[model samples]
Target: MVNRWASGSLAQRGQANRLSHGAAIMPVLLIVGGGLFGSQAAAYARSRGIEARVFDASLEGAASPAAAGLFKEAWAGKRLAEHYRRAIPVLDRLYGIRGVTLKNDDGEDESFQCVPPSAILEKKPVLAKVTAVGDGWLETESQRHEGWVYIAAGIWCQQFLPELAISGKAGAAFAFPGEQPGTIHAIAPGRQAIAFVRDPGFTHFSDGTAERDYAQEHEQATLSRAAALGLTDTPVMRFWGYRPYTPGGPVFRRIGERTWLATGGRKMGTIVGASFACRLVENELRA
Candidate 1:
């Protein structure tokens, strides 16, 4: 196979394998949809071996490339943060996955890293259960890795809510390629987070849509944006529909008989999304 994502991380041990075998391999029911919450949750099911099928409306709606597979802890609140923190182990164990390109499902990762990334592993918790934790390609003591977290591309949330609501004022995003060579940069920062990237500049087919080209442009623009904002290298990503804005933030609900949904708010759903999937699995299995 061409490899959708990449081979499992050795540091993750057999966690990915176990997630697929233990969580997905078992008898389970699956429901797939769009919206940041549903799309990532469905992808989590697949990573866990749930073989959760997807129902995508368009190509870009389901966007995570290889980079999407990376995980992070860049959310908004404590409860949400803890919730994702709780979901990591379930994700770590879900190591063995195929059918990946450089990007997430949406074909974006190759624009970032080519080979499957190397992870620095750790101990993560699934509620009271301790599980293996695999960080992303980038290594740091903090879980908040400022990179992409591949989870079946941009996620399929847009399907359910085609007009995904955003908070920022409506504004047009302009595209620019860079000096580094491959990356493409499109910035449309606003008061809140109303930036609609699903329809990023390159949504339509283009001739020179190479990753290196886009990277060069993005890198240069990123440098300028950083300096203008008077900040060090800060974190910015596909914070579309429902991306967290708090230290421990995410989608959750304790209202009904017992149903909750959580994914990393930012694009780092790999770790955060997996963490939530584990909780969902545990609840289903335990129930």
Candidate 2:
């Protein structure tokens, strides 16, 4: 049976794990979609002494590159919460995550870097910014690590796995204006304090016609919400992309006896689904 739910690390463990214990080389697993999920999958597999190749059209509007790079924890629903638990530690170990927050008591903004496992395992705050002293104030340090830029990560995977395939498409999907770095806030709807990403327009896209009009509508709605929240300065960026969804949720479909279809990441493709898919495929191949 193949285990499901997805999305690792490097260094002293050896950046490349294609061969270990003088074992035979592993077979290459072909993963489609170069978004966050695919990149994470490839990276995870490489670290486990498995060879994996990722392919993406890299078309304009592809979700990964256009993504705001928000890494958030899921608090609702057992399935998603579990995915978050599995992914967070591994992602943090491999790539240090930068913490950002506009919420503070000193009326000052702050940022910090962290490795999740170290923070989690040691039960200590690695780079936490203290907002209060005594009692509850110390709890913030236990949480750390979350974020990604899929496109650049895919490129990095190629460096680690030289034979990895990452063919660029002809047309670029989205356009990023201005050279200055910008901030994109992740807001979780309702009572949850965690900021998860959910674009109703993209998540509910019906066909090709939707994207042509999505920008204007998305901007207007975002602005309205921002205004209501008194966050008028929040920048809204729009892009078009395609995402595949399966009713059974993401799974590893065995194609014949050798190949497998690792997809169905849906909205959580980048952070949760992608990582899970990669690991699932890696384990199957090893078995």
Q: Which candidate is the best by TM-score?
A: 2
Q: Tell me the deviation in Å of residue 134 in model 1.
A: 35
lDDT of 1 by residue, 107-183 (tens): 35432211111221111211121011122222223321111122222323222223332221111122222111122
In angstroms, give how far residue 28 of model 1 lies from its true place. 5.1
Give candidate 1 regions above 4 Å deviation: 1-28, 34-51, 59-63, 66-81, 96-220, 223-248, 254-264
Per lDDT, the best of the predicted structures is 2
Candidate 2: residue 276 Cα off by (Å):
1.8
lDDT value for candidate 2? 0.38
Off by over 4 Å in 2: 1-24, 102-215, 223-238
lDDT scores in order: 0.31, 0.38
